[model samples]
Target: MKTIAILVFTAFLMISCTSKSNKIIAQKDYDKYMEIKDNKSKDFAQNEINFWQAKYDKAPNQTSYLSQLASNYSKLFENTGDVKYLYKVEALLLQVNKEYKYTAVGPIRSLGRNYISQHRFREALVLANKALAIGEGMKETQKLLFDVNMELGNYAEAEKNLKYLTNKTDFDYLIRVSKWNDHLGDLKTAITFMEKAKEIAVINDNKSLKIWTFSNLGDLNGHDGNIQKSYDYYLKTLAIEPNNSYALKGIAWIAFSNEKDTKEATRIIDNISKRHHTPDFYLLKAQIAEYENNQALKSKNLSEYFNMLNTINYGAMYNKYNTLIYADDKNTAAKALEIAKIEIDHRPTPDSYDLLAWSYYNLGDSKKALEIEQKYVVGKSFEPKLNYHLATIYKANNMMAKVAPIKKELLKSTFELGPTLEKKITNL
Candidate 1:
């Protein structure tokens, strides 16, 4: 009787929690909750910014104060995804660099982080290298170097730096290990490392860290064809930080890709776009338009996406997206090839090579594409999108035997491909 009662109570609790979660808080209610929950953090960040600003104002020539103020602005920018805060970050950091002749490791490293946030990876890499030179043997600087190297597709160099910084108990180290494993085509090992990192975050009681881990695990699970798990993680992230743009985007993808509900996907993204002004949001809208067979809307969204990209200093930021847009459009094959070459020149990773091969295939150079695919792309990445691209390339090159296995693997990723693309994949 005791065991039965406990089970009944557990089921009741589950139902109660689900009912509460299903009660959609109106926008007003959500706003009230956020105002009460988030204003404290916002006000705290502003207070720090004011404090640092006063110090910098009093000592106009003090580089340390300038760097501190810049860091506060960065914190504000991160807390709120406002581009204006980034403008201030760039200005203050530039002033500090000018005063110190770029010798101060703090400002340089901070500026590199800002560049990374803006998707200016090549610029970030240059500044990271400078930070390393300025602060040789510093672990933090080495970590920045490792991240920038990975962004640039310098896998060997990234690994070298990572080896010097790896620590089992360190959150950043574990996440990096997960990313490296993912890049090396080991999804299972990658997920294990990410889960370990998430466990560490939970044990540390770090809410921000937990949010980051949950969002990343959501992405990893999505990539690995675990759609329900991915959706759960995204929901968990939203439960903590309701305005997390990445989690919103992840859930929006679940709506579009897994649920085949374009209207819901549009609603989620539209809500997010009203809050966050990221260029990728527009690109996603374009993809949705394509899926819905709205050519005029797709072109309009794509144009808006490019226009938004032009306004931001995205150094090597959208190469992958550009490659896909250009190659798939066929009319832009030469442009795609141009971007692919730039990607390969910056980071000769397998994904970059894959882009190059796809560009060649789009340009009707199937023989060259096949050669590059065999030499670089095959067995290098387990990404479903990469596999789909490779399989299509194989088909174009008359490799019929190679097509079936890849097609079989890809069909399992129906959620990843979205309903429209999944239908096309089924045809393939």
Candidate 2:
């Protein structure tokens, strides 16, 4: 009888552990964050913009008011995810740069950042170089150069720029190092560096830095398979900035991907969409609909996404998403190939090449796809989606040996890829 009791107790303990592991997120933890409707940040940004615009109108010669207006518009873009505000900022910054005769590093660097946000990495790099030639803000320009070079896949140049700003105790240096480590696939080291940066953010008590650190930690933790830690970090982000759409989206991802609670995920996304209205949210909703096998809902969301893209002059910002979407349809595969080539010209990153390869694979040229993957995509990118494409291209080319390892790796990334791709990855 004692032996039977011991066995039952062990079984109960195992079951309890399993249950605890499975339940990573609780609605109560994020319910208040979701209920936050008032966008105080956006209100303040608009107020600042109005004040700056009035000043600029009164003193047309004062370029400083233009800079202030640009800053406010950037804040609005950050808070609302509106591309129009971003474009407004870009125009204002360009005017500021022209007024300064491209000699001022401040507006030059700002324009470089704007170009980076627009995915115009080559343009950003040129701006960074121009800033470097000005020699007014060497360290800042080095940092911008590092960022632009990384985006353009100029790793050696990025490393040189990183070396120029190698202050281990500096918050900016720490975050950049963390990004470098992440790019190198040393996730544990990357998280450690980011955690150090988070500590500095806490010590400085800087709201923007804190929000950036917390939200980035959420992403790194999610990629590391620490979904509970990721959820907690996102909650911390929301605690600081209640209207932070990125943090809310992270929680929505946890609900959808880890918990498979599609209804809760959709609810959170819908709430965010009411205010943010970013096109990517529609894509995410469509993905959720696909997972639920709601074809009509999926089609509606995709149509909305495409309509937004068609209406907005987003430049190259959404090219990758457009390429992937078009690559999946037989009728649009040619367009996907065209955009993929444009994306390659824009950045030439391995991920861009993966899009090109995937487009070729979809267009019924596995040999060309394999050639592109071998030259650019293989061993260059560690993204799960890119690896899935690599595996698909390999399988199509009768390279089962290459496909096997990638398939194994992808199976472990089902949570990150979400429920919709689980069967697809399994079948790979």
TM-score of each: 0.83, 0.94
Residue 20 miss distance in model 2 (angstroms): 11
**lDDT (Cα, tens digit) per residue for candidate 1, span 24-110:** 212332232222334344566789888877987887776788777777776566555566777788998888888888887877877
lDDT tens digits, residue span 1-428, model 2: 01101111111001100012286778888888777758888999999998989988999999999999999898888877778988999999999999989999999999988888888889988999999998887988888888888888888899999999857789888888888988888888989999999999899898888988888888788778777888799899999989988788888877777778889888998998888877888888888999999999989999999999899877887888889889999999999999999999999999899999999999999999999999997888777888889999988988899889888888777777777776797887
CA deviation > 4 Å runs, candidate 1: 1-47, 79-84, 118-123, 134-137, 311-315
* Consecutive 10-residue window with the lowest summed lDDT within model 2: 9-18
Number of backbone clashes in candidate 2? 0
Clashing pairs in model 1, backbone N/Cα/C closer than 3 A: none
Flag regions of model 2 displaced more than 4 Å. Answer: 1-21
The whole-model lDDT of each prediction reads 0.72, 0.82
